[model samples]
Target: MASDFDDPGYDYAVSVAGRAVRTMAEQRIPPMPTNFAIWFQYYAGSHNNLRNAIDLLIDHNRPFDVSTNQDLFETCIAPEVSAVVVETSERLQA
Candidate 1:
């Protein structure tokens, strides 16, 4: 029997992460945590709005400047981060 660590899903996730990092380097986006989270979600195809926003920006040839990255993080990743924080706090309190 194969170990859980050998699951194909793990490989897929690694592939997505690699693509995210490569795309970030190509776009000159910083390898900051928030930026990586945003790009990871984009490459994972799990967040449509985030993907659409990024696609629009790329389509328009917009630079991923600090402001643009900040906007993307706020719009795309902050809500998920807030939810995780809230869940963790509740779990700890429980």
Candidate 2:
């Protein structure tokens, strides 16, 4: 199993989440949560499946919320859009 951070094809948003989590851990700063590492792991294992998951989330009219444990009203919603960039990159690669 590849380390979550080391996976080359890992989703970009997921990778950002990983970095956010790491920053939170190392600097004691709050990060955008939402099981991003799980997303990373999933992307590493299967890009297409991850894409489908992203698509389903998009089709349902969601905000791609990443804040699992933060103030709902305080979190920035646009950063969440990065998930699209990540998924699109992966699909392009495929």
Candidate 3:
């Protein structure tokens, strides 16, 4: 059985973050933590569930591409995420 902490994504995330930092340095982008975070989040796209879904597909030997990308977005990603424009709004309302 696979544990959440052992997810292959941790390695992928580290690699991407390192690349982000290096790329910024090479291009002379500001070395601020905020800038690094912005680039990292852009790397993840707007969808919060995207990385997890792709990880699942890759782990199962499923083909992930443009066609399947739309399928996953519509069928899984959109539905799974909350509709809140501001997630904290719920807390404020309560």
What lDDT score belongs to each candidate, Candidate 1 first? 0.84, 0.45, 0.54
What TM value does model 3 have? Answer: 0.39
Give the best candidate by TM-score.
1
Give the true-structure RMSD of model 2: 13.7
Query: Which candidate order results from sorting by TM-score in descending order?
Result: 1, 3, 2
TM-scores, all candidates, are 0.85, 0.27, 0.39
**Per-residue lDDT of candidate 1, residues 1-94 (tens digit):** 2221233487897998899999989988889998988887888787789999999999999999999999999998898777777877988999
Give me the runs in candidate 2 sitting further than 4 Å from their true place: 1-34, 38-45, 65-94
- Model 2 vs. true fold: TM: 0.27
lDDT of 2 by residue, 25-44 (tens): 65343433444443443344
Error of model 2, residue 43, in angstroms? 7.0
lDDT of 1 at 68: 96
**Residue-by-residue lDDT tens digits, candidate 3, 5-40:** 233487777976887687557645576654554345
The full ranking of all candidates by lDDT, starting with the best, is 1, 3, 2
Model 3 poorest ten-residue lDDT run: 1-10
